[model samples]
Target: MNSIIHILQTQGNDILNSIGQHITISLVSLLIAAVIAIPLAIVLMKHKKIAEVILQITSVLQTIPSLALLGILIPIVGIGTVPSVIALVLYAVMPIFQNTYSGLTTIDSNLEEAAEAFGLSRSKKLVKIEIPLAMPMIISGLRIAMVMIIGTATLAALIGAGGLGTYILLGIETNNNALLIIGAVFSAILALIFSALIKGISKLSLKKIGIIFMAVIVLMGGYFGYKTVEKPQVSITIAGKMGSEPEILINMYKDLIENDHPNMKVSIKPNFGGTSFLYKALKSNSIDIYPEFTGTVLESLVKTNKDASHDPKATYNLAKKLLKEQENLDYLKPMKYENGYALVVKKSFAKKYNLKTVSDLIKVENKIHAGFDPDFYQLKDGYPGISKAYNLEFASTKTMESSIRYKAIANNKVNLVDGYTTDPQIEEYDLVALKDNKEFFPPYQGAPLVSEKLITEYPELKATLNKLAGKISVEDMQKMNYQVAVKHEKASKVAHDYLVSHNLLREK
Candidate 1:
């Protein structure tokens, strides 16, 4: 309870910002869904067979997992508010469409016959009689949709849409229960308020409804007008992976760059699913720059086998040249840390099996269970690379979220797990990093990949960001990660502290 209150106190402004963003997304989605669904529903009333097929299709879309839908849309629409609104609009369609169809179809046949007897035209009868009578049911459907949209809008934060869900996802990522509760509770309140507002609107006279809608339009116009007036000179979006180190670096970069150029407004789009998602988002221009590793891009993305070995400079040069010629992306300066993937095992399990390296895992083949993120299983530099190099196989493999793998190993649910060398969880869970005797993995030096177009526009940004080159060592990054992933500190605070300590930022 105290923690919740503290979060509300410290983050009051952020909470309000999220509320406004949530209202905007939900309202816009509901409006779009209504525009399409109502007309489509009317058309369907004329074609029963087609209506059935369309209804089934909408039902299937609703059944597709929300996260899965976001994933599909991210590749096509990239990320941020556009994809989120599109997904929410699809979700909002079913209820409104069904209700409109039901209401129009259930109107009394006798009334229609009476109107026909009175010489009323088809369009006039629909406009004057059918729609007015069905308004109550349609309004009720809108109420239901409003509530569902409000709830689902919270998930938009996962793709960096910036709503109440931002707090929730941040809380989960940082292990802050108070922040999570604040987001969940506020979203519920918004839903309740909107539901009540819809109910009230349904009870209002036609004139009053018109007045309220006009007021909403005015408010929307004013909001947009304010945004246009205050638009920044330069708006830059920097994105990164889901882990602590990437999170910190992105925040640090945002702070330093924005501070250096007061006219520039820097924003972050975190949790871009993974490497593949980030890469696609960059190519599609959904994001400008993101933190990536040279070896990951070289071996996994570029599919290079020229044997750069453990040399960071060689790996970075090759990555830079290939990305420039192939993808039109520039690889920035490399950091001091090498955070490649490591096959980890509980110390006790390693002791029992006499396992010291990837080679030893092969000796115990078919005896141990392996747990890994689905991405790790699919990527070439993941299980495939390790398995082929060491000729190792596990008894059973389970794919799950990367965040939970640490706990799964700690609790003895899985014997071997794929982990990053810089992850604090290995130390927290008392796990051992198995040696890669074959050196199948190459150097993974962290760096930013920027769009060439962005550099052409803001050439100064390259130097501002590169000031961080070779600044953060493995120990510094590991500590920062431990502070966030272990101590539950805010990523921004950790990043800020690091920048200040390094004298990278002018202290305010």
Candidate 2:
């Protein structure tokens, strides 16, 4: 508990920023849903058949999985707040409209007759009598929708939309309970705050609620308008895949580049999404650069035969060539360390099984219960190729996230799991990496991959980037990862300390 408090105190700035983003996303999503669903509900109130059809359509939208919806939106609209807001709006519309429709339909006929008898116009009657009568139900619907929006907005982090979910996901990845607790607690608090606010709004007159909403809108607009006129700077966006290593590497990239070029502003979108997400973001100019492994580049970004050579030099050269020829991406000079995949197990288990190599796994294949990440379960250079190369198949397999697999193995829930050579948890959990004698997986030397547009615009960035060439060995990476993941240190601090100590960056 003391450790968690310490972490919270140290990460106060980051948590506050995440809270601001979380509030903005939640409120914006609910506001948009209100604009669409409330008016639609009003129109549908007089038409029973149309109301049923529209409600059914919205229900279908609600049923679409959040991830599936995000997946569909990414290629079309790209990542970040736009897609996140759109998906949340879709989920919110159903609840908002359904509750609103119920409220409008339940308004007493006597009240409408009284307003009609008072010579009130249709719009006037709606404002005077019908609205007052229906206000409770309408506010009820908004409260439900607002609470839903706040909770669901956490998913936005996966698409580079900043929120508390960033911590939540990172916590899961690093097996850090403090981070997980902070994210979950803050998210719940946001939902509760909105719910309380809506309850208070329900008690106030309609005019007061309208005033409050307009005030919020005006403040947000003014803030953005003011920001729009600020002094301009050359901004470059750098993104990375999930995990501490990528976050640390991007932090180094940011520090090195910004320290050298004071006029430049570096925006980091760490843990933006998966490999495909980052690649697409780069292609779309959403991100300028991200650290990618040579193995992933060869396997995912480009096509190759099943038996592509796993040699470090051969793979790096081929990846560099193919990326340039195919995607116009420039791969920086490779770092010294290789963060390649291996079949990992407890030291005791490996000793018991005499599992010294991937070939050795074949002998006890039926005894192995392995957990792997989604990509490893399906990718050619992963399970499929490993199975073919060694003629091995596990007795049972569970597909899970990269981070969860480590804890799963450590807890003795699964006997075998996939691991990157530089994962801090491998050392923390006392696990051993089984030798890949068959060379089924490619060498994953890290390098910064930049879009052509970025380099063309800022050609000097190449020099700053290449400064990391042949730097950061496996042991060095593991130590940095441990500091950030286990010690709960900020990635930026860890990265900065490493850079200064190694003379990679002068203290400025």
Top lDDT: which candidate number? 2
Candidate 2 is scored at a TM of: 0.90
lDDT, residue 89, model 2: 96
Clash statistics: count for each candidate: 0, 0
Against the reference, the lDDT scores of all candidates come to 0.83, 0.87
Residue-wise C-alpha lDDT for candidate 2, range 1-508, written one tens digit per residue: 8868988888899899999989988887888899899889888889999999999999999899998898788778877888999999999999889988898888888877888898999888877777778888888889888888888888888889989989888888777788889999999988888899898888988788789878878887787678678846438988888788999999999999998898899988877767887888788877889999888887779977744676899989999999998888889899999999889999999899888998998788899999999989988778887888888878999999776898899888899998888989978888888888877777999999998999999999999999999999988998898888877789999999999999988887
For TM-score, the strongest prediction is: 2
Residues 1-508, model 1: lDDT tens digits: 8877766676688789999989999998988888789889887887889988888888888998888788788879878788999999999899898888888889999998999999999888887788878888788889988999999998887677878887777666645567778888999999999998888888877568768876887787788789778975437889977656788989988988888888888878765446776777777777888989998787667756586556678889999988998888888998888898889999998999999988998788888898998999887778987788788778999997886887788888988899887877877788888887787877888999998878888999989889889888866887888887666567899999889888998777
Stretches > 4 Å off in candidate 1: 1-13, 39-79, 115-128, 167-189, 259-263, 299-310, 345-371, 374-401, 412-416, 427-438
Model 1 accuracy (lDDT, Cα): 0.83
